[model samples]
Target: MISVQGLTKTYGGFRAVDDVSFVAAPGRVTGFLGPNGAGKSTTMRMMTGLTVPTSGRATIGGHAYRDIPNPGRHVGVLLDASAQHAGRTGREVLALGAGVLDLPRSRVDEMLETVSLTRQEARRRVKDYSLGMRQRLGIAHALLGDPEVLVLDEPANGLDPAGIHWMRTLLTDYARRGGTVLLSSHLLHEVEVIADDLVVIGQGRIVAQGTKTELLQSTGTVVRAVDDAALERALAEAGISSVASPDGARRTEAEARQVGEAAAHHGVVLLELRAADGAGLEELFLTLTSQTQREGAAA
Candidate 1:
């Protein structure tokens, strides 16, 4: 439902987003990950046609957002700040946006409900909104036209844990219904749970993109084991092997569960198993981003 090719965005001499490209397919949630200042918001803006890329293109269903007829109905976007007339009620604000695209007013009411803002709450002036309420209003605006593709940047920024959980389920459910969801957030663990795929970037360039398992596999190793000696023997017979460490602390968190599952099937009492890559994702992200930053500096 979405495609980007060689997307490049620069401000002055510094590229905020460089050569970044990926796709958000229908029926899947694609998590866009990067550290702070990695140009994630810039990339989202470019995708929504809010900001023009200095080079390359971002398209929705094969058409550039700018050229797409009735873009409001084709793409839904919630960036960092949502602009609404404070004096206007939330319902009025969403209705105004939907009206511009000639969408039915019922869609506006439906969105308000979908985002869980009741009719009375939706009637309250936006200026009275809390941060979480404002966020929901922004989401309501995006869903005003029932767009096929949704792009949200740091959507969980001001949300409480409950709100964040709600957002996760909502986005996942949207994708499950064949809509395309592209979300950018710093919540790696949350992404790891709901995202079917990930696109990781640093210093404005995509360094990785794939299913979380695929990306995890590249940055680390996957250890599999069976609890039985026979299963261990089977793995050996199948040519699967793991490195032995004196302390047996090698299994990285990424592969620990898989390793445990493997060990259980084999009936082998696994004393230890771990990813050979040997580090938590927090460390992995730091190493990866720092290395990219160093490369950018040297270049």
Candidate 2:
């Protein structure tokens, strides 16, 4: 439902986003992730038309955001989730939001309750609301028009554990019902739980884009066994390469779960079977980006 092509944004000499391209499919939540100052937010802003790109193009359903009628109704956006009128009550703010979207007043209350902002709190000024409350309020505002596509930046930032779970569940449900969700987050575990697809950025460029399973599969894993010598011999016969630990420790992250099962069937003693850090999506992200940065610096 969303496509970004060669979307590049530059701030003088620094490129915030560079030649990034990806697609957010309907009926799925796509994780937009990157390290600190990797231009994740900049990319989101450009996609939502809050900030124009220096070059290249992004579109929703084949049209530029500005060309969409009632873009708010076509896309729900919660950029900060904390920016709100300090003096306005949650209800008033959402009500005003409804007006802007030409939605009914009931939508205001519906979304307020949807985000679990109690009637009492809804009546209180936004200035009195906690960070989480403000975030929910921002979410309520975003949902006021019941848009089909959602672009969220750190939606779970300040939410409590339960709140974060709720947010994840809600996003999942939305996608299940055919909503397109493009969420940018720094929380890898959180994204791992919710995202079916991922688009990773580093130094303003997209380094990886695919389903979670696809990205995870891209980097092979090692599984370690307690009987290092025996396991290494077995793996060598099986055509798998493994290194011996300095202490004669035998370990492998060679695809974890399934490999463990296979090894067990082969009578490989179970010592420790878990994913090695260097072979997962997280490791791939760090290794790829850091290498790129080092190369850029050396040049």
Q: Name model 2 segments beyond 4 Å from true.
A: 218-281, 291-299
State the lDDT of candidate 1 residue by residue for 54-168, as single tens digits: 9999989999888989888888888853566899999898888988999887888788888899889988998888888989988878777788999988787778898889998
- Alpha-carbon shift of residue 271 in model 1 (angstroms): 18
The clash count of every prediction, one per candidate, is 15, 11
Q: Indicate which candidate wins on TM-score.
A: 2
Worst 10 residues of 1 by lDDT: 244-253
lDDT of 2 at 279: 42
Quote the positional error of residue 241 for candidate 1 in Å. Answer: 26
